[model samples]
Target: MGRQVLTWIGAQAAASGRRYVRLATARDDRPLRAYYERAGYRHVGDPPHAKWPTSLYERAIESG
Candidate 1:
């Protein structure tokens, strides 16, 4: 269900001329990170300025 929602949101973003969708999650949340990975998001790395243990992920929008 979450994957579907993310896909839908990505679709909307892509339709609006966005090239990517980026997000962050706590480093300890393995399950949620895995979910995002399965949904086609790639782990980029943590932001240098973040105060917490956050993992960054980005997904490229496919051209239709």
Candidate 2:
């Protein structure tokens, strides 16, 4: 299931000019971080957004 989703995302990113994809989860989503990391997302940093902390990660698609 994860592989299928990743493949779909890759295809979507290729078709669309998506520079990066992000998911903002609650603090209690600590367990889910491991799953995302294994999918090539790195923990870039955490920045406070709105009233919650946002975990930022990115994948490069093209040169800036």
Candidate 3:
């Protein structure tokens, strides 16, 4: 079941012509953010803010 779901997700991403898919979560969401990095995402930087900071991540897609 997991394999089937992953396969479908890959197909959709490929068909969408997306460059890369990144993962991020709020500071309060440390667990979720950790998951993203573990899934091959890199920490790029933080978002513009005054009171608090926002997390940002990036992943590059294959290019033809």
Candidate 4:
């Protein structure tokens, strides 16, 4: 189900001429972080924010 949702999102983003699919996750969630890493998203950076700690990730959209 997660992969399906990612596929759908990639499709939509590609249709709109986007270059990448970016997301943020809680920095301390190791399991969730691993899941995204296994899904091919690379750890980009953690930008400063006033709210909860976040880790950014991005996956390039494959040209069709």
Which runs in model 4 stand beyond 4 Å of their true positions?
A: none
Error of 3 at 28 (Å): 3.8
Instruction: Report clashes for each candidate as comma-separated counts.
Output: 0, 0, 0, 0
Which structure among the candidates has the greatest lDDT?
4
Summing lDDT over every window of 10 consecutive residues in candidate 4, give the lowest-scoring window. Answer: 45-54
TM-scores for all candidates: the values are 0.88, 0.63, 0.57, 0.93
What stretches of model 2 exceed 4 Å from their correct place? 61-64
Please give, for residues 1-64, the per-residue lDDT of candidate 2 as tens digits.
Answer: 9868866776678679787766555545786777778777777777765477566665554433
Name the regions of candidate 3 deviating beyond 4 angstroms.
1-10, 50-52, 62-64
Question: Could you give me the TM-score of model 4 versus the true structure?
Answer: 0.93
lDDT score for candidate 4 against the true structure: 0.94
- Candidate 1 lDDT, tens digit per residue, 1-64? 8978898989898989999999999988999999999889999998778899999999999998
- lDDT comparison, 1 vs 3, better candidate: 1
C-alpha lDDT of all candidate models, in order: 0.92, 0.67, 0.64, 0.94
In candidate 1, position 13 carries an lDDT of 89
Local lDDT at 41 for model 2: 72
Q: Per-residue lDDT tens digits of candidate 3, residues 1-64?
A: 6446534554566679976765445756787677667655688877667256568776565555
Q: Which residue pairs collide in model 1, if any?
A: none
- Model 4 over residues 1-64: C-alpha lDDT tens digits? 9989988999999999999999999998999999999999999988787289999999999997
